[model samples]
Target chain A: MVENHPSQASKFKCEVKNLNFYYGSVRVLKDINLSVFSHQVTALIGPSGCGKTTLLRCFNRMHDLYPGNRYTGEIELDKINILAPWIDPIEVRMRIGMVFQKPNPFPKSIYENVAYGLRVRGQSQRSAIDETVEQALRNAALWDEVKDRLYDLAFNLSGGQQQRLCIARALATNPEMILFDEPTSALDPIATASIEELITQLKEKVTILIVTHSMQQAARISDRTAFMYLGEIIEFDRTQTIFSDPTHRKTQDYVNGRFG
Target chain B: MTIDNLHQLHRLIARNRFWEKIFIVFGILSLLVGIITLLALLIDMTIDGLPRLSWQFFTSFPSRKYEEAGILSAWVGTCLVILVTAIAAIPIGIASGIYLEEYAKKNWLGDIIEINVTNLAGIPSIIYGLLALGLFVEQLKLGRSILTAGLTLSLLVLPIVIVTTREAIRAIPNSIREAACALGASKWQTIWDHILPYSIGSILTGIIIGLARAVGETAPLITIGALTFIAFLPDSPFKSEFPYISFNWLQAEFTVMPIQMFNWVSRPDPEFQSNAAAAGVVLVFMTLAMNAIAIFIRYRLRRRIKW
Candidate 1:
């Protein structure tokens, strides 16, 4: 059993209490209880089919797109219950952005791709959108490479550039929190290193919850780490302790690469 | 080399080469058959009608005398009827397809609608003509006019339009829709901003092909009682007065190129036969032009959007 520390609770940006999720009566998340701190990076690390990505999706209700998926439990973002029936998924999504595993850029020009989020959210001024688009690209470390050819089609860029373009697109919306579901898994090692650098810098401004398969990536960038196994969190602690001296055997075994 | 080994190798090479030559000849003959038939018909039509095609043939009204008859009113009515058909069909067809692919729930009702659409596409064009004749002309009292003919042809091609639109929408990857939704876009916004834009090129190709089919239709218009001979053009859609637009010609009498050609071919006069061949050539050219435009636009858009 993990002890709850009361002093650290109030600083949380999001809290999941007794969360249970189901896909057509088959339980996928078993009584998940966790909290993510504000302006910090928390990484969720687990093997395949352990429900890490599933739990990440619950933050923004990405599973609502399909039928027969249900969630029962309290999920609070800044003291508001995001799982309440009255809350709109679209509204929740605007407050919290998500980057998918694959780099799915819109079939449009790079400028339009970054501007799409702002444009759909009702930002119509040309000058304002232009400034925000530039800022986002710069923040994602892609402005210098693509600034000259913003009007070109997004697919014309290489894979790494496209992924960074997606990041820029998410950042343009100015969300308080961003979710990363293995954002670098599809990228090469060089691209992955650049994205890790970007993520470390991003935590200064926004809260982040990243799901990753690489244990080293979690140890490298995250301020906190949660080791999940078979739909449950086995350990949650400071990244240093989780890597060096975890309280749970499962965490120690998995971290040392004995087995996934 | 041993005598037996040389003999076996020579027989094997000779047998394979002989079969390869046979297959090559067959493939060339199959391709040539279609090209030869088309070329023969084109040459025959040119020889019979090239001299008859002139500015007067394009501008003069149909006359009782074979020498004086032209297809001016027929071609004009063809344009007017096609315009009406496009206006009525494209929106409804595209909307139905979108609703089925994006909005409709996957249940028995949806299944029935889908199955029925496929079945409707396979039904004969003459059946749709009879349906339109009964519904639009007789029951709705639209009268045997341009509007009635347009409505009938729209029905004839509606199935084709719906089927093709659905195919185009299906070709889009689901990831694009999910990406749009993840960006905080609502259902309407996702469809309008992402789904519609990416699939629009394909939808347009389908619509143009459908419209081409509509233009070539003869039975539906005939069933709806379109006139065989029309000497006067319909009124202009533009007005010099207040409102500045008019649809007064929709309810007026009309005749199209195919009907005019049919009437000419049924005549006993050799000159009228030549006129019929000329009209057929023009109709074929129009269909080919529309198809060429569709192919060009589809190619351009496919290159632009790699996804």
Candidate 2:
């Protein structure tokens, strides 16, 4: 833990080593190595079935939620093996909260959705839950739009508001890293732009890993970007360098919309 | 044919409003038929059995004479059987459902249990009675006591409780469980704190329906030899004298409402027939009360856990 911080040369606040994953002998992701940095947003751009989400799910161990989806490598958060058999997936998830591809607000009031994590973690007092819910929603940039009708059911919110509530739910537990699995994929363009702006603003205090298919979104919001192709990341560099002068031809071709 | 068809069209066109009025009258007549059928059943039951609906009918003991036999013992026996049966069935049935839905692995054992549970729900009630006779009465020596009858009834309703409970548990989405687990809650905590509460409304609805089915069962109680005109009040679920009870579960016999109705219906006396209908009315009211309790709990739980 002591060796994790204060290393300028270290590109990753969290790192994956020799990562490989399989779903019942059908390989979904092949050897992957990447380092996510603190205080910066890193975007992963790849077409569908390119294993972008599979690799992002590695961080929070969401794949383990399903039996028979096996991994054979190490995902380290502060030098601890995340994929270790003894590591508690629930604890890992709390540390690395996820915003799913779809806006899945719980079938509950918006206020409870925001306060869900705290309440589930055994915090029962109204004042603390209320305070945390307010703070999390504020952090997700959704408090103003929903403060008046927090007690109203979450389904009453429009698509964009629901997406923000999902983000707020993830933020409620004060996670160290936030993994977004194509969070804007289901939203309209206006909502997508708003989410992109929120991600940019969020990088100062959180390590953000966004798996997106949009090359423009990667260039606009990410400090660094990784291009994954066929279960392997082909390139990783500073966002502009990878977009403008990518060393790998496949990365260059894909970014230029030549082919998937 | 041409002249008749043209004349009919002319009449229909001239009396369109009259045809609409005729159709409306027929529609209302069909609805009234349904209401009248139910009303007739109630009124017939009331007219035949209302004379026996007195304090003596409840308090007096059975007699060899036509006018002397009271439902006191059979009533308490039936109540004892039903209460014990529900106590035995609800927890076991509900817990089994939760286990199958949440914890069971996708394997041959789970598949077999699921299939067996559905088939159990379809078995004839008399078959359950025989099984109870062979197992509870003969092998265990529970005798023709109320406990034996209660056990038989519990088995009768177990499958239904399980099936309904499985449906209720399935109605809850996986997202709620995931959300709870993601909050660093234990497996048990997630179930107790989220899954169970989320499913309580539906589970209670299923149990009430199951209890209604339990209360109406007659053949099984008869197989266990429900006392036809028992008149002594049950001592308790604990007492061992005439109202057999024991602190240890080794000694307890009980009675229930359906058993009393069966006892009254089986006698040859005219008074006993009226008494049977009277007991039927009470049984109907009890089942109705259970159904209402279920609906009330479902509505209350829904309001409390709208999430």
What interface RMSD does each of the candidate structures achieve? 0.9, 2.8
Highest TM-score model number: 1
How well is each residue in B185-231 modelled by candidate 1, as lDDT tens digits? 99899988888888888888988888898888888888878889888
How many residue pairs clash (N, CA or C atoms closer than 3 angstroms) in each of the candidate models, in the order given?
Answer: 0, 15
Q: List-wise, what DockQ does each model earn?
A: 0.75, 0.38
Residue A93 displacement in candidate 1 (angstroms)? 0.5
Candidate 2 lDDT over A109-219, as tens digits, reads: 899888878876778999988999998899888999999999998988888888899888988888888898888989999999999999988776678999998899899
lDDT of 2 by residue, B1-307 (tens): 6999999998988798787889999999999999999989878887877888888877767666646656676566666677678889999998999899888897899999999999999999999999998999999998877678777889988998999889987877776766666666667777786678778888878887887887788787677665554545644445546546453332344445666666667778778888777767777787889899999988988864533
**Deviation in angstroms for A44 in model 1?**
1.8
* Candidate 2 Cα outliers beyond 4 Å, as residue runs: A1-10, A108-111, A119-130, A145-156, A247-253, A257-260, B1-47, B54-76, B134-147, B236-254, B299-307
